[model samples]
Target: MLRELKILLLLIIVVGIIYWGVEPLAHSIMHPKVAPADYEFKDLDKIDLSKGDAQKGKKLVTENCTACHGIKAEKINPPMDNASSASSYGVVPPDLSNIAAVLDHNFLANFIKNPVKATELSHKFGDSNPYPMPGYDWMSDDEISDIVAYLASIASKNLSDKDVFTQACDRCHSIRYDKMVALTPDADLERYLGTKAPDLSMMIRSRGPKELSVFINNPQKMIPNTPMPRVGLTQQAEKQVISYLEKVGDSKKAQRDSLGIKIMIFFAVMALLAYAWKRKIWSDLH
Candidate 1:
């Protein structure tokens, strides 16, 4: 009886492991999963901060963005200005008062054009249908840059480089700036662990430094049931993550190319499987 019980327990453990692995595989196979894509911010690195016209940008924002984003760029859904009642959607619009301080230009631009990629909180935090923000892909790159400049000018506080780096980057990643610089770009650090590491390229494209920083500080606050743990980070790490994101945003085109390669690889694997099945290649093994 004891031997039978032990065998049953072992079988259950094996079955559980197989089940867990199969779920993710099934999701990948059945769903037409849209892999995250990078956004190319044209010539953003070449932007001349000295030449930025914040006042002009502000005027343009008033004329165009105020209707949806708000006059002070504070409220959108519940109406920050009114505060009398929440919107029918029961979600308060995100306040943009400290947007420049809280988010990087790349993140801000992505949010304006594709709110889906702006913050993981959007997907993780609320219901499936949170208040929808309009996409402004029609806006010119210059106009977007100008708006960023204007926002930076009005923001109450700008995070110091150290503060940002410590709070954001160090929270989740085991990043050593000096060590990172010393390693060759192609070095596979995870080879020692016999497992592949998660690609950070997608992370940079999907989230800005500021949003990442805040999420690191308290993931539960943003998304109640998030699997991410809150790693207490100093402000410096947060700033570093923000700076890193800015640099990543400049290489957005390259990131997109990499994403395309991944998609091709996925299809290639699927094709190989189909060919093998057609040829009965696994008949003996099965």
Candidate 2:
């Protein structure tokens, strides 16, 4: 019995070693190193603004940008209705009309391309504005240069239509005009129009004024699956929102009229089919 007990104790020690050590080693081997690329610092000392194309930069802004930056380069375009209110992230979006006057072109370009690196350098070196600006690394070096050039063109007086929107609506929402405008494929335009958090882009493109009115009156009734709560609106306010959406949609590649017509046809066909089926079933029952 004593000999058997000694053998069991040895087995337990070996099992414990395998469980703690060998298991971890196996896991590490299974998940081989998957690290990010090594950081390479660019030398901004040789950048020449004379060679940059501001026109090309403007085109890039119109195509890949303008969602957050606004067409007029007025910092937060489509300014929030209220400037003093807290945002969803508890921070307010700042204005950018005078950014060129404040920051160097190279500094702006580098910061835009790699926000994390810019922040680290700022913290290590002495730079103003410690806020972490989000990166736009997807843009090529030439594109970044053009963006910087176009940004330099923004005057304090040349605010866009978004600025007008901000001045009107910033009272309640955390209106970060720049951030919202910068979002691509025009994602925020529908939310802005609906006054509720629904991807109304598809609906806006597919449905017309009449259909939108029905949904707006009682969105949950029309779309039970939708998370949008019906915010009671005056007829005038609803029209304004619709008009805004129509204009904004036209400016972008998204077309609402086409979508609205398709939705109408689909529902009409379904209704006719349902009526015929019901009539046939009733006759058979009789």
Candidate 3:
């Protein structure tokens, strides 16, 4: 027994040393040194959102965006299937149907101004892709805001949670809820999106809304090498999406939490009873 105890002690010491030795290295790797200026739109967190005119936004979308994006259930370009679209561009550009329902004004403005910078990939990798979406850096900030407002104005307020997620997130993300499955196969998905997207069923519970908001708004700000694109969702749409996530992932959190307290109390009572019974049984011996 003493020999076994010595071996166990040695094992624990080795493990403790290894953990302490690796901690600093892990921290350094996770928090790489990058100049503040290197970060794209680093000042966006401090920028104030400007209200936009949807009527003006509509004109801008027609003049600037109709080449790639479609609206009003009609294809501005020929209806190319997913394969064809993926072949042309690395990934298919999602439709803008009711986009205002998913994205907030702030996100729309930032993304529309410079999608590459918003995603932060181009800032780091220097635009390595063969087919890149050019940024509208020349468009005045007001014009971008107006475009966002236009999208928001036409957004369907009555859209279900699933519809919002499908339009906003389903293009890349996969949620393993009920019958909902991944849109792209693994082989094809990796070729375009760079990596297989993680399932978001338990995402809300794992990372709360605040964390999700920061990450969703600017993934690179939170995670240095994430493949997630900049999805400029409206504030209201973000809330709706969070609500849906809570329904799917943490629906029973309240009930489960309540039950947990009762269970702990029952265990405490049983423990006390067990101790009292032990005392009674040993009284005669004492």
Candidate 4:
């Protein structure tokens, strides 16, 4: 019994040293500055949204946005087909019908004013390769506020996890595990974003949820000058998107954990039996 206790103590010390000390120190060295997720988007708080008039916004949106984006719920279609739009704009623009539901309000306003700056992709979308959306800084804040109101009023509610991920991420990244391809082809995305977006099928497993959330909220801070944009998803939508990624990447996690518990039980029983047999043989020898 004393010998068994000593061996157990040795095993515990080895595991504690590796798990509690070495692993954390290694992770800290590897990821020296992992920034926290910024769901609030505090920088874009200047606009006063209370002054918005949805009726006026409707007219403004019809005059401005319809030429490029389609609003399926409102029965508005883009003037050009996907191929034609891709040819003209370098990538097909996403529909505007659900934009308000997923995107943060403050971030949305800033994105409209200056997409390059808002997305933090000015490093790539500079003068050499112009960004597709022309800045709307000339529009009055009141007009922009009205547009935001109209968008919020029209947005669909209670979007599913898959729907949230589709709206927030599927436009740029592909999930090959789910058989979902990116909306924009790799060649066009390469030209538009400075590189093709990475396939996100295994990102959840690789990066884990905490890292994914922080990186998604602010890609620029995670990797300086990353071509990937700060998507500006609302907190709820961000959670939904990450949930869907976990569903796709770790679908069998529950089953795997259950099996692991069973395996541990089997090992414990075998260890007890082995110890009992050794004690029986040693009793006769002593």
Best by lDDT: 4
lDDT digits (tens) for residues 1-286 of candidate 3: 4776799899999888778877767866865643322223345432234667888988998888777666754335534665665566656667776776766556557767766665566643454563246778798777777888788778777988778777887666677874465554555667766778778899998888866766766677677777676666555656677778888888998899999999999999998899789778879788
The candidate that achieves the highest TM-score relative to the unseen native structure: 4
Q: Tell me the deviation in Å of residue 256 in model 4.
A: 1.9
51-97 per-residue lDDT for model 1 (tens digits) = 55788778766766655444343333323332221232222243445
- Per-residue C-alpha lDDT of model 4 across residues 107-206, encoded as one tens digit per residue: 8988888898888887888788878988889999999999999998898997899988887887688999999988877787777677878999888899
Compute each candidate's TM-score over C-alphas: 0.36, 0.32, 0.70, 0.91
Model 3 residue 281 CA deviation in Å: 3.2
* lDDT tens digits by residue: candidate 2, 1-286: 4776799899999999999999989966864433221122233323445656778876776665544333334434643422222232123333445444334466567766765454333332225433323568887777888877876776344434444333222322332322332221123423322233333334446776656655554454455535333333334445554555455544453555678889999999998899799779979988
Q: Candidate 1 — worst ten consecutive residues by lDDT sum?
A: 178-187
For candidate 3, give the lDDT: 0.69
Candidate 1 stretches with Cα past 4 Å from truth are 1-52, 68-85, 120-131, 158-286
For candidate 1, give the lDDT of residue 137.
Answer: 66
Clash-forming residue pairs, model 3:
102-233, 103-233, 103-234, 104-233, 104-234, 104-235
Q: Which ten residues in a row have the lowest lDDT in candidate 2?
A: 81-90
Clashes of 2: 18
- Runs with alpha carbons beyond 4 Å of true place in candidate 4: none
The lDDT of each candidate is: 0.50, 0.49, 0.69, 0.87
Better of 1 and 4 by TM-score: 4
Q: Estimate the Cα RMSD of every predicted model relative to the unseen true structure.
A: 18.8, 24.6, 6.8, 2.0
